[model samples]
Target: MSDFVTPVLLMQTLAAVREAGRIITEAWEKPRSIKYKGPIDLVTETDVAVETFLGKRLREILPEANVLGEEGSPAARPEGTTWIIDPVDGTTNFAHSIPQCGISLALWRNDTVEMGIVYLPAEDELFHAVRGEGAFLNGKEISVTDESDVEHALVATGFPYSIREDIDIVMQNLRAVLMTTQGVRRFGSAATDLAYTACGRFDAYYEIRLKPWDLAAGWLLVEEAGGKVTLYDGVTPFDFGKGILASNGKVHKAVAALITDTDD
Candidate 1:
């Protein structure tokens, strides 16, 4: 693994994600052709269009790197250098005319994330992190909050699509956090929530049932910003199957304890 990522490659990936965000935002502004993958899971024409655009762009720049996107790619584990993307992070919000969505992109080399970018087109905020390098937001260095007390921290979280089918588990977890934290928010986009946490806008975040495309980029960003990311049991947050618990290092243990207590 190389110790440095060229600014050119980073810029290229950022541009691609930005371009994809623009395409999704444009489609979002107008009426969209929507489809259902399941009862609550949604897919929009823009989702496919953006993924195609991103896959093609990334391939042009890093042809050897495998691409895994939310709308495309096989179920194979990413090998060598792989780019995992979520063209539109909040498809549910996009379909409903809410502007709280963005694009997420991450490059993994040898099973570890080398770089990641999250772009919020509506806000024009770009969050990025390169391995061994610090995290940034709009070219300015950013860091996690110093808040250590879980009771004083503002936390964010999300419910999985299985909430309807597993309502009891979801509600119990939600209630646990709500009663413990100073504040709680559910933004429908795990990428954005994690990005926000990295920049100190949120002190911590946790959720169950997320995909690689959902947390790949944001995980690197949070860690680079001096935050902690792991499962509710305090394990590394690399599993695509289980959910995650992330905080600014200070409150991680407290948050993990709360989550596990809720489970118990």
Candidate 2:
């Protein structure tokens, strides 16, 4: 892909994402009326408000681009360029008063992600990456760690909402990795976990049954940061429905080996 992301466009997009995060943060600090979308799934007023705000701003800035958001998207996936958005990535955590949620946005040209932005309002951290350009966290260039030994690496992971029924498979994979890694953490936010991995805060990250909005932006950030991300089988992991595995390129192969089960 050509360098379609000019510096001005990048700055504008980052500003929009930051503003969206601020909206979420404001609602988070106040009393939020929450409801259930599914058995354990949730939907908050903040999520809808943030998504609406982002969709409007993005359309005004890039009218030619389509939008695919977690809260609401077009009936059919549009052709050419599209924006994937997750207004609040860690809704469960946010509902529980945990400050681990954030907003994730990605621009997809054809089938490839051209740019990504993830903003954490609570921490005032902004992570962004453009195709072929390096990743950054709050204006500082960032890269994955060079730690090659799995036993010496800190790992991060998340459980699928289907954990109620597929607990065995998820636990089995978790157990396998926990035994080999130096430490494991479940922060309940896939975007944040992947962003952290790209910045060397976490050596690796993995998760199952995530949507495109959950991984699209963060995936590009990790790859641009000199890291590697793929499916459990070591293939390119672009399908939003399947799952994802990401690492600092050092323990990627080792981690992939332990979670290669295909049977659901």
Candidate 3:
């Protein structure tokens, strides 16, 4: 593989993400123009504006690369040197002026992630990770927690937009997780959930039916920070269209049990 991970490239990616994040915060300050992709899935004008702007910025950073952004790239797949972007990860939270939204960008190639970034404009936090190197938050190295006991671990999760159909399983897993862990939180933003897992604020996170842009950047973040990312099965490789169970390595199997095949 060619060298896509460099100080210069990471710097450029961060600048673009921070620049794009401004749109998220700016929109939160105004009345949102909303539309529904489904009964529960939301789209705001700012989501489109940020993705459009960020996609162009990323292409400039790697002119030969493909840009697959959630807002516009419905039919696009991960081609050579693809940059996957979620312009605003928590559109509902953003539309409601909630402060938990963020922007996620990842560079994927040859069936692997090369680099990833998740920027929370409201908190002014920029988290990043490269494939072999460890993860970072605001240029400082970071890692997942050392927590090993499920009874003391703080886990996070998000509901699917297809909640109505998935509710039975959702509640089953939710109930299992709640009974197994110290606490469970629903942040409405998978990027935030994964970022928190990476930085040790959360011991683990799990959610079903996430999109490519949702898991691309944050998956690398968790693993690079000394955590684990996988499907509920605990052995299968996780990808864009798969459900995820991400946790500090010590608690991965334990958490996986609760969210995966817990008996009712």
Rank order by lDDT, top first? 3, 2, 1
On a 0 to 1 TM-score scale, where does candidate 2 land against the true structure?
0.95
- How do the predictions measure up, each by TM-score? 0.95, 0.95, 0.95
How would the candidate models be sorted by TM-score, starting from the highest? 3, 2, 1
Query: Distance (Å) between predicted and true CA of 113, model 3?
Result: 0.8
User: How many pairs of residues collide in each model?
Assistant: 0, 0, 0
Candidate 3, residues 1-264, lDDT tens digits: the string is 227688898888888888898888777678889999999898989999999999888889889889888989875458788999998999898887777888989899889999989998998999999998899999999999999998999999998888888888999889998988999999899999999999999999999888889878999999899998888877677766678989998988888787753222
The regions of model 2 sitting more than 4 angstroms off are 74-79, 261-264
Candidate 3: lDDT of 18? Answer: 89
Candidate lDDT values, in order: 0.85, 0.87, 0.87
lDDT of 2 by residue, 1-264 (tens): 337888888888998998888887787768878998778888899989989999999998789998998889753333478888999999998887788789999998967889999898888899999999899999999999999999998999998777798788788889999999998999999999999999999999988888888888999999999999888876666465666889998898888877744343
Better of 1 and 3 by lDDT: 3
lDDT tens per residue, model 1, 57-154: 99999988889889897664566788998888989988887767888899988778889899888788899999889899999999999998889989
Query: Which residue pairs in model 3 clash with each other?
Result: none
Model 3 reaches what TM-score against the true structure? 0.95
